[model samples]
Target: NGVMNLSIKDIQGEMLIVSQFTLQAKTAKGNRPSYIKAAKPDISVPLYEAFCKSMETHLEKEVKTGVFGADMQVALINDGPVTIWMDSKEKDY
Candidate 1:
């Protein structure tokens, strides 16, 4: 539904996605990140786009995002209905 305007990569191995969808991605080699071998636009891109669509729908709002193909740290914070409204008064922190 959408295209990644950015890129995603792991310089080290410290990146920890709680869902770990990439863990199960198929590859030519054995169990590894298989990033290089990962034919992204062929597979991951569509899925990523679909995820974006479903995600925005589920949230019922336009989720702010970065260019997926761009090198950046990706961490999804699953905050369920944690809506906060700001005002001139400090009624709620």
Candidate 2:
């Protein structure tokens, strides 16, 4: 609940919440990435749904989401070359 919510609200933006477990991949070892830190489907599914619901509540609009634990393809045109990443575990940022 901060700038992200404000920016989206100001722009009347719609959000697509995708459950990308790969974001938690650990790559310090070999060529293959490890998803050991990612939560299992049984745990993540509920959390994902809850997150979408929370966002909808805060945004006062319907939020779209992808199917959890499913192999899906996403397509989006990059508005600009910039990308930002944030992690809940790294709250100091």
- Backbone clashes for every candidate come to 8, 0
lDDT of 2: 0.84
Worst 10 residues of 1 by lDDT: 10-19
For each candidate, give its TM-score against the true structure: 0.39, 0.80
Stretches of candidate 2 above 4 Å error? 1-6, 90-93
What is candidate 2's lDDT per residue for 1-93, written digit by digit as tens? 353445777888888888898888999998899999899888988899999999999899999888887899998775457588865575553
Query: Which ranges of candidate 1 are over 4 A from the true structure?
Result: 1-33, 36-39, 73-93
TM-score of 2: 0.80
Model 2 pairs in collision = none
Superposed by TM-score, candidate 1 places the C-alpha of residue 80 at a distance from the truth, in angstroms, of 13
* Candidate 1 residue pairs in backbone clash: 5-67, 6-67, 6-68, 6-69, 6-70, 7-68, 7-69, 7-70
State which candidate has the highest lDDT. 2
Instruction: Give the 10-residue window scoring lowest on summed lDDT in candidate 2.
Output: 1-10
